[model samples]
Every structure is written in C-alpha cells, then in structure tokens.
Target: MLVVAGAMAETSLVAFRGWPSEALEFYEGLTADNSKTYWTAHLTVYETQVREPMTELLAALEPEFGPGKIFRPYRDVRFSKDKSPYKTHLGAWLEAGGYIQLSADGLAAGSGMYQMASDQLDRYRRAVADDRAGRELTTVIEAIEQARIHVQGHGSLKTVPRGYPKDHPRLDLLRHKGLVTWQEWAPAAWLGTAAARNRIVDFLRTSRPLRRWLDENVGPSTVQR
Candidate 1:
C-alpha cells in the first residue's frame, strides 16, 4: 500500500499502481510521430495510461521526500533550432531536491546540483579545497559508487581553476563546475512493478550522505534562480 501518513484520512492514500506497459508504448509512438494530430488522437492514452500512474508515484513519494511538480509536456521551441513539438520524456522535481523522469528508454532519478551559479561555484570550490570536508566528500562518493550508482559532476574544467594549486590533493574536486548523483533503469519487467519505486527510494536513500555533505559544505546558491 502506498500510504503516506497524515496525507489524508486512511482511506484516501492512493496505492501506487506502477506505470502500465502502454506508457512506454505511448512514448515510442510519440517519438516516431510527434505531429499534433497524433498527439490529439492519443491524448487520452497519455493521460490515463502514463500520467495517472506517475502522479500516483509522486504522491507516494511526497510523504517522505516532499511534494513533486511534474514537467509540462509542451516543448519550448522559441529558442531552439530543432523546434520539436513535444518532449521525448516526462520529468518532475521534488521540492526536497530530487528529480524523476520516464520515457521510452527508461526511468531515471537524480539529485544534487546539475550546475552552480558563479558565486555558488566559488563556495563549492572552497569547501572542496578544505582538507577535512574534501576527504569526507571523497568517502561519500566512494560509498555511493560502491552501491553501483553513479556520482558525477556537470562539467569539469580541463585543469584546476586559476589560483588553485596545480598539484592540489583534491585536484579533481576543484575542477568540477557542479556535482550530482544519478541512476537509471532501462525498460525491464521490474519497471512495471512496484520495484521501480523501491529502486528509486533506495537510490535516493543511499545518496543521502552525499546530499548531506553538499548541504553542510555547499548549500543553495545565494544567487537568484
């Protein structure tokens, strides 16, 4: 049962029924035919078969991880050259700092900063340079990787930033522009079962130490979003 305590009366908790097989099929079809006519014809399937289950999954995650906002299906084509009509995947972000996505390829979850503003990057570099904090982060990253999940940065400088020692002990840390934890689940039988949610919950839980390290050492950007 996908019951979140205090969410509502006991009777109101929605049991998460995993995404149906048709959810992937819908995306597969959309990928091939992204025309508005195709979307209009299949709109009902997208809502009932794909969106509903995802909404339930997010609701279930809300009790522990906080509320999540689903991404709008409409694509922003004004600035893009490709000008695709819709996104190939569905995505959402939780207020508590987590992301989820579903598509024909698979489901994915991620957390941590994808990219930091200039000010935040400066602070992050300072923390990474701190001997004790840097070592602690190394341990956290190692543990997460040992669990078979990936820990990586958004973009890394070819070399250490200026003013940082060329031979610094945490050389790799100083080169990072941003840091994040990510995991993906390719289409599988388990994905259609509650195990999908379990795997995500496990990944997020395992990555908690890394998130905590960031919170303590490199918090939210002081710069406006």
Candidate 2:
C-alpha cells in the first residue's frame, strides 16, 4: 500500500469480480525485486489491480463475515536480519473471523486463533482436559478435516504441560499453544473469477465451528500482550 504523491484518488468500492491475472504477476515481480524501485514503478498495478479488488472483496463480504482490513504490504524490517522491503502477498483478516491471502503460489484462507496467550492457554488447557469440552473440540476438528481442510496446532509442547497427564487422550490438543484450519488453492482459472470469493466464504463457513468452540471454551487472553 505505498502511495506516491499525486497518485489518482482511491478507487471506490465495486462488487468483487475477483482478481485479474496481473495481480498475481505483480507479486511475482515483487518476489524477485523487493526494493523501492520495483514498488514505485509498479504502484499503479498494485493499487488498481491488486489492492482495489481486495477492497471490493472485503466490501462484498461485509454483511455475513463482518468487515475486513487488508494488511499493509510493506515489511517491518527494522528488527529482522533480512531487510526485504515488501510483502510478497496481499493478506486481510475479517473482523469476525478468518483470513485470506493472494500470492504467486495461490489463494489461501484460514480460521481460528493462530496463537494463544498465557491466560488463554491456561483456559485452553483446562477446557481441553474436560471430557465434555475436549470431546466437542475433537468432533469439530474432525468435521473440518473431513471436509478436506487441514487443522493443526502451533507452538506445541513436546510433552504434556505441567499437571497434565502425558497419557491424556487429547494430548495433541493439550500440547497446543494454538489451533487453526487452513486451505489453499494453487493458481487456477477460477482465481480470476468470482469463484475465488465463493471458495473463501465456503471455507470460512465450514471452519466456523472451531472458532465457536474456542470462543466458548478458551476465550481471549486476560494478560495484555
């Protein structure tokens, strides 16, 4: 989202017709040359072709999924060893839930918490230890994976945490610091059509039970970040 001086005004919202082929190609070029020159030279294409369509998609999805915000494409290189200037993909998160990204590889969508905090992890472990909540979560994850989406944990402990039995039936859940469901589609003809939005909507809807389970059981962090 680099805006040059005197660039044309922001593009108004339109019904999401899906991204054009050029949008993916823009990221391809950025991946090769992640410098100011590449970004400045192609800002027009990024704005009109890539950013505008993303905005439209977010607008179209507002009613059912709530609002969405696109993440800025610039990379925060101040603390990283690699100083690449820009992100290679466009990503956005819905206000209610779910994430979407478009890049040279493909379109991808995800739902559920990516990571849990200390207090949240405590709650997660307690709920996961309970037979009722644990079994409910197991059913939700199974249904999601059965629909062909991938569900997995992140930052998992090698063994059970303190006070949890190592032989616990839901050891996978107990070890997790986070849980999420993901789906990806390689670059395809449907990507440049409304089918892209439909796919994302379906994935989000299908994985919603997982989000609901976590919200009801684990909730959010009490300790501030």
Task: Report the number of the highest-TM-score candidate.
Answer: 2
The deviation in Å at residue 125 for candidate 1 is 0.4
Give per-residue CA lDDT, model 1, range 1-225, as digits (tens). 346555555535466667888999999999999879988999998998788878888888998889999999989999999777988898988877888999999999998888889888888899888888889989999999999999988799999999899999989888999898999888989888778889888988888888888877788777866
Per-candidate total of colliding backbone pairs: 0, 0
Model 2 whole-model lDDT (C-alpha atoms): 0.91
Candidate 1 lDDT:
0.87
In model 2, pairs of residues that clash are none
Index of the highest-lDDT prediction: 2
The residue-by-residue lDDT of candidate 2 on 1-225, one tens digit each, is 357432433433266888899999999999999999999999999999999989899987899999999999989989999999899999999988899999999899999989999998999999999999999999999999999999989999999999988899999889999999999999999989888899999999999999999889988778966
Cand. 2 TM to true fold: 0.93
Clashing pairs in 1: none
What candidate 2 gets wrong by more than 4 Å, as runs, is 1-13
